[model samples]
Target: MRKGFLKNRFVRVKLPALLFATVTVNRGLMR
Candidate 1:
């Protein structure tokens, strides 16, 4: 129960930011 709630929160915020940062870094490397 508690784990599920934290997982949802992570997906809502942390996951997107993490993915965005990774993408940006990849783009920078591509340059």
Candidate 2:
């Protein structure tokens, strides 16, 4: 149960970071 909770937290953190990075790259390309 503890491991599952940690995995969920990791995914939550990682997903946003990944999304932010993608958006920044896309914006840079558009400019």
Candidate 3:
């Protein structure tokens, strides 16, 4: 149960960072 909780937290943090990076890159390309 503890392991599952940690995994969920990891995904929540990592996903947003990855998404932000992608959006920033796309915006740079648009300019």
Give candidate 3 regions above 4 Å deviation: none
Against the reference, the lDDT scores of all candidates come to 0.93, 0.98, 0.98
C-alpha TM-scores of all predictions: 0.64, 0.84, 0.81
**Predicted model with the maximum TM-score:** 2
Error of 2 at 18 (Å): 0.5
Ranking by TM-score: 2, 3, 1
Over 1-31, each residue of candidate 1 has an lDDT whose tens digit, in order, gives 6999989987899878999999999999999
User: Which pairs in model 3 have colliding backbones?
Assistant: none
Candidate 2: where are CA atoms >4 Å away?
none
Shift of residue 31 alpha carbon in model 2, Å: 1.4
- Per-residue accuracy of model 3 over 1-31 as CA lDDT, tens digit each: 5999999999999999999999999999999
Q: Give one digit per residue, the lDDT tens place, for model 2 in 1-31.
A: 5999999999999999999999999999999
TM-score, cand. 1 vs. native: 0.64
* Residue 14 C-alpha lDDT in model 3: 100
Taking every candidate in turn, the Cα RMSD to the unseen true structure, in Å, is 2.0, 1.3, 1.3
